[model samples]
Target: MRRPLAEQLPSTLVAALSSAFGVCLLETTGVLAQVLAADSVTGSSATVAALLQVVASVFIVIAVYVGSIVTANTFATIIAGRTRTIALYRLIGSSASDQRRAVAREGLVVGAVGSVIGAVLGTAITIGLVSVSVATGVVPSHPYSYLGPVIALPIVAVVLTTWLASWIGSRRVLQVSPMQATGGAVEKSLDEAAGGRGRSVVAVVFFALGGALLVLGMVIGLVSPLGVLVGVVGGLLSFTGLVLGSPLVMPVALRLTGRMFGRSAPARLAAENAVRYPERSSRTTIGLVIGVTLVTMFAVCVESYQVIITNAQRAQPEVYQGVDRTLTVTVVVFSVLMGFSALIAAVGMVNNLSMSVLQRTRELGLLRALGFTARQVRTMILAESAQLTVAAVLVGLVLGTFYGWAGAQSLLGSITGSPGIVLPAIPLALLAILAVAAAVLTLVASVAPSRRATRIAPVAALAVE
Candidate 1:
């Protein structure tokens, strides 16, 4: 049965309300209890309120980083698939303003859906964690300040922030030219191939510069918060080189490893395709690399931080906690960092694969003309994603596992510390499986775009030239 938009809206609003209430309630429980302990209505109410607000803000920011990237990439591909629809509207006398309105309408839908779900999930997680905290006496249980400034003001602010972020990030809908709409642009020919030496050069140079600055920031302890910003940006920029630089490196790397791909026909085909448009492929690869590096770097930093705190704890108990709480915090923090990183990587995989699928639309059309079923063509595209996920994940797991182990041993094995656990096979395997599954899910997201590409008739594709 089909559901009306109005019906959906009410449920969505109900969901949103439940989400807003729970989000404020669970996260603010600890500090809210403190405020209540201080009576929550005293002159210091304002001060305690601010402290609780800060904690909520921090968690919201984490949600933003983790949630935003996946939403952006997913939305981008969906909207890109709409270029033809948008172009048609323009041709039929719709102004750019009209086109933008359509884009905005779509953006609102996506933003609302994502934010509401995120809020609900975030709230549920907060409640579970807080319940555990209270039971463990990590935080005292008391009534929370949920009625006043604590709930009303911040909920409004968070909703606005979420809607704005999604809207802004999905603004690429405005960039499609009406002339490109007729669906041809989505499946254009090799002769019309784009992205030049300039992009490659820029990516490579940025890669070098980002690396230099990142190393410099690390050396200097990033004297300012600006340093952290620079390191993150620099880390992202390095992928410009790593991805664009892939063809140059990949061919050689693959020449040594090409036979590995030959173990399977699909792998052999996927590898050839990966190298076919090395420049574009590298751009896609660059995105994944950015995600992987950010995650791996942050993962290393977090573990290192814990090791330092733990070693200090080993020497003196009173200096720290009644017991080692750092380990618990470290796991949560590292897991959060990796989840965000892996998500970006997953999105990167989706973005690159969608573009690749689009680029090969004509090929799929031709295959269809030659009697291949639409599902079969879609399978080929999925195969490409599967192959890339396998290859990228294998490399990432090997390197990340080694780096994690080495970093832990160096930081935790000294007299100042007891040797913390290294990359135990179980946890490492779990994370690896999670990363692979995430990459596959990302590939699945592009299924619609791939099917859309396959829908193009061979005649139209050939005419697309």
Candidate 2:
């Protein structure tokens, strides 16, 4: 029955996507807020209202992009874990196309249901929040008449996103052969599956292009005034390059971290386990990379902007005070909006780690039989989580700092007449706090799976094949 398939599917992914969709739906109220405020302002021009509408639309697009990527990554992890199941179906004479269709159909069903629930929940929450704001006199009373269209947009967007993610996630399922399935080799080494030389070439090219673009953007800022926007674009390209090149980089990083803190048996084993399946580790960390990258990038850029404004305030204090306050508010709001993406990333990491642990039951059981304590097993899981968090945070910080420095030069150069790049003082303590939080969250998520893993007898686990 379909119930079995449903059970195998990741319910957490469904919930995360639903939450993301609900948040996106709630954002539509920004447009409504703008329209209402414009109507109430005695001297507000139609042009100003139209501009606010455009800004709201831009935010919506950004929300959709973040939501789609998170959904796709989560779904892909779930699909990848089922590689053996898909292959078994193929071995029993089920066509690859049929299996793919089944997966896609399941996605559609989940998407539809999740979208409806998200829409309803989002609407109710938004209404409640707005009512409180109105009562507190923080916002004037406004009619809730625009809720209908606002509710529809996220439902449509999420449904389409889920469908696309489902289709894309199934591509790997189709590539898995019956032989690989039977051999339990569905999760092959990245070098073997990706072709070592080809991957290297691609990585090198992307890294070079990204670096070149970043430098070029900085240079352009020295002469032309449009460097700020160019730098931002280049920063994005650079981060994308880093992500694409992670398969090559992850092993080196893992080895270094392992050697540094892997003196203990549990730490050593955890490090080895992570690098042994480099592709899986990379995939598991991609969501975290996306989330952390955005956070660091925004943080650095805002600090740079603050520096520029601080210098300007010395000359015309009153004239720039309003601009400074507006920028501050903008950064805070933007941070809150982007925090949702980070939340999704955390959820994905937890799900991926849990699935990975579950898949290694046989290995864990053998270690146990060989006298590995339950405490050791738990420590190993925590060690792996720590290593992943370190990698993600380090990458984010380095790239974000560079981008922020370039952006500052670009933005300030136009006004100051060829200013040098000034690196913003990043809050290392805050970043450390974030890294620790991520590690703790991942470790907590591992508890249940670790417990399940330890409960299986060695003989039973070894007999899983």
* Predicted model with the maximum TM-score: 2
Highest lDDT scorer: 2
34-102, model 2: which lDDT tens digit per residue? 434534331144533543454455345445555555566666777777777788888888899998888
The TM-score that candidate 2 achieves is 0.79
Clashes of 2: 0
Q: What is the lDDT of candidate 1?
A: 0.49
lDDT of 1 by residue, 33-66 (tens): 3433443233244433543444344344433332
